[model samples]
Target chain A: MERVISKVTFDLAQTSLRQVNHFLHRELNSETPKITLLNPDGAHNLAVGLDATIDVEIMGHTGYYTASMNKQATITIFGNAGTGVAENMMSGRVHVKGFASVSAGASAHGGLLVIDGDASLRCGISLKGADIVVGGSVGSFSAFMAQAGRIVICGNAGDALGDSLYEAVIYIRGQIKSLGADAQIEPMMEADYQTVGELLAQAGLSYQPQDFKRVASARQLYHWNADADQEY
Target chain B: MCGIIGLLIKQPHLRDSLGELTVPMLIGMGERGPDSAGLAVFTQTLADPYRKYSLYSGGKDFPWQDLSQALQTQMSKEAELQPHGNQAVLTTDLPSTTLKPWLKAHYPQLHVLSTGRAIDLYKDAGNPTEVADRYHFKDLKGSHVVAHTRMATESAVTPAHAHPFTAGEDFCLVHNGSLSNPNEIRRKLEPRGIHFETDNDTEAACRFLEWRMREGDDLATALQKGFEALDGFYTFLMGTADKLALVRDAFACKPAVVAETDEYVAIASEFRSLAHLPQVKHAHIYEPAPEEIYVWNV
Candidate 1:
């Protein structure tokens, strides 16, 4: 039997975010189909708290917290997204066709977030587990306190890349202003090359993995030492 | 939190729509800041060689005509007074240095917002839309504009505490973060005979840049010096007669984005503010790096 695909549309200027989210929640786990949102016009907290295997498309620019706390949902933003896009996501994919603002994928446990355009400061802060692929440059303090996952940047990275990171992998093709505490440049091996190539392929980007520099934790700052503590 | 917007038009055809385009961008961040709003518009030079001073009066129905008449009599030159909301621009043949001191000594109730050959500033403590309407912003035509919507982090919500603080003859600045060491810098600038009207930290940063420029430092050199001397989280959009510049702190804690098209260069605290710009879909968008100065000249 062919599964039926259901479609829903909400214009935020006419309807409220609460109403739209409520309808989405009710439709979760049913057919798990497509939803369209229009006239977002920089409104905050849109399409939040979704835990279904559904597909959502936002037509215009959105404010903070767009597509946050997602689980098994494929969300796409046709225009720019404000701060905290795809924040704390557990699974699924969120793709931004336009630019994204600060804290693009903060504290996401799992899933893949792809930004076709540039992302601003703190692109992947405190990521427990996730894969973030940015086609354009990312601003400073990116991958700060990252616990796990892989972040691939096809363009340049700003200052303090991967600050205080633990066990996470960061790949950048362009210049890095500075490396953060506990983050060190590591040579890209065959496995790293294959992994980055796969992620870039998934992101629909065609960049050579050899062009990127892999970064990982130094493991020196993970354990607290009395002498090191005294230096602070 | 605050919202900063700047639009610099490269095409002559788009110059008339500068204010029309900026109003919506400023209002888009209404949620980030609702306390006050301000803007500095740079228009074509006056027909005659004259300096324009933007002045604000706390009270409505300010005696602008009387002031103009008084200036005309005192300075023995033609003076024109144009009022918009609580703000007014005084155009005169008198030099800025002489006119500024004379106005300060005479009109204690009026506040000088800015003085330049092409810049006119307007601001008020109210909702962004209301303030924009009050200033009749839709009717304004300029080559570029720098605007701010303030949330009042460290200072009182007054007209004087607004952003887009004018530093020198045509230099203005708008900030989106708080400074950690404003008083210390203020103390250093005061001994150099720099004047201050508000306790806002943004004003301190503005004065510091102005003083550096006065001491023969160019805009780029002054801003580079500012990166070393100024402390705190900040994303600044500064403008002069011919250029617009952006800079962030080393940490890049505050948010800022820049988008450029063949027609114009627009910057805002968020991408949402830049979404509606003309040819934005094809615009080259990017985020500036920390401690790196990006400047665009007309």
Candidate 2:
């Protein structure tokens, strides 16, 4: 038997979130590759911790940690997403067609996160290793203490951008309000341009890579210096 | 974490369903705030010298008619009482200085929730849904509303400690985060004869802002000063006689979202509470920025 169902409509209005998530976790097989969630109604933890390769579509707005700890799946939200949309994902892609609240991809280890609209404050706080692309502006304290990976911002960035940044690099095409301690604007090289171009294409945005500026760690605060007296 | 919600209707017809529409918003945040709830609503402004006072009797079954008779006989004024179980709203043209002291001397157990020409407040130590149903929130009519559901991180779980704290007249504030320097704020205002109510941190902020307004600073300026004076994480939503205001601290630790339409302006700590609103799918939704005072007039 082929045993393949092309599309499944899981209406959250008639069913409980626990049943849906349980089915995704326990009963769903590779044959059930696609599931559409209707009437999400801003519920929390809608489809978290999935290890299968599947397509999940959320019809409406979602609460915090909607697709956190995701693996081998593609989750899409047609409406806005709440805080920490894809936190600590191991692998996969989460696409938010609408705006996102604070900490959009916080502490994610690996994944591709894309936002079509603006992302609020601390968009990628404590990010480990995730490539995030934003089509619109991002709020303050973005990319704070990000240890690895890259961030692509197609629009302006708010205050204290890339604060205490580590290895992660931020490429912004718009104006910068202010930069945080030990984070500075650097000249974009050939590799930087290629990286920005590729990430922008992945995020489905077409822009001139030459117009963007690269922001990265200055490496001054990497280790403590005894000679300096509380100055960066 | 606590939950904060505010709704300010722009159209005159929308005010009729203010509380009916707000009940769902309040209950939607039950996961974040299941301890206690409070709300301050602003209705049509009364004429000069006329005010409405919201009183809570602490879950006691008292004769509200007897209190009305005493108010008429002792103070020699025509006052009307509309009771809701343990709660009542007393309307009169009497001065607060004259009536408050009389009430204090006569019925000491009654807690004065709020007093102003256009405001009526209700709060209790119960679930948000229970509190709403108890006060018949579905029937409330108002131009603007400021509500809070408390989880009590830094205070007790008593009705006195609930939010939507008021000071002076026609102004109320609800806070979603804790304050770090309440004692410092208290040390500055106590000498000026500003009485302290509950030891809750929100009370300090309420008194401080009310004092600044009393000193002739408008709500926006007072909030600018609040940015410098108050230290801690806070997302404050406030309601006045003719306006609704919101602000967040510089750190922006707390969360607040605004959904504005042609008919009304709605604010909540999260989008969940606002998902079921009318025409919300088309509402202009955005999070409030840090250190910005967003004021919408009724």
lDDT of 2 by residue, A1-232 (tens): 6676678889988999999999889988658579999989888998999999899999989988999999988999999999899999889999999999889999999989999999999998988999999999999999999999899999999999999999999999999999999999999999999999999898889999999999999999989999889787
lDDT tens string, model 2, B227-271?
Answer: 999999999999999999999998778888889999999999998
Q: After superposition, how far is residue A7 of candidate 1 from its true place, in Å?
A: 2.1
Please list the residue runs of candidate 2 whose C-alpha ends up more than 4 Å from where it truly belongs after superposition.
A1-5
**What docking class should model 1 receive?**
acceptable
Top TM-score: which candidate number?
2
What is the per-residue lDDT of model 1 for residues B217-272, given as tens digits with 9 covering 90 to 100?
A: 99899999999889998999988888888999987777787889999999988877
Task: Provide interface RMSD per model, one decimal.
Answer: 2.5, 1.2
Which residue pairs show backbone clashes in model 2?
A: none
True contacts kept of each: 0.37, 0.74
Instruction: Estimate the TM-score of every prediction.
Output: 0.91, 0.98
What are the candidates' individual DockQ scores? 0.46, 0.75
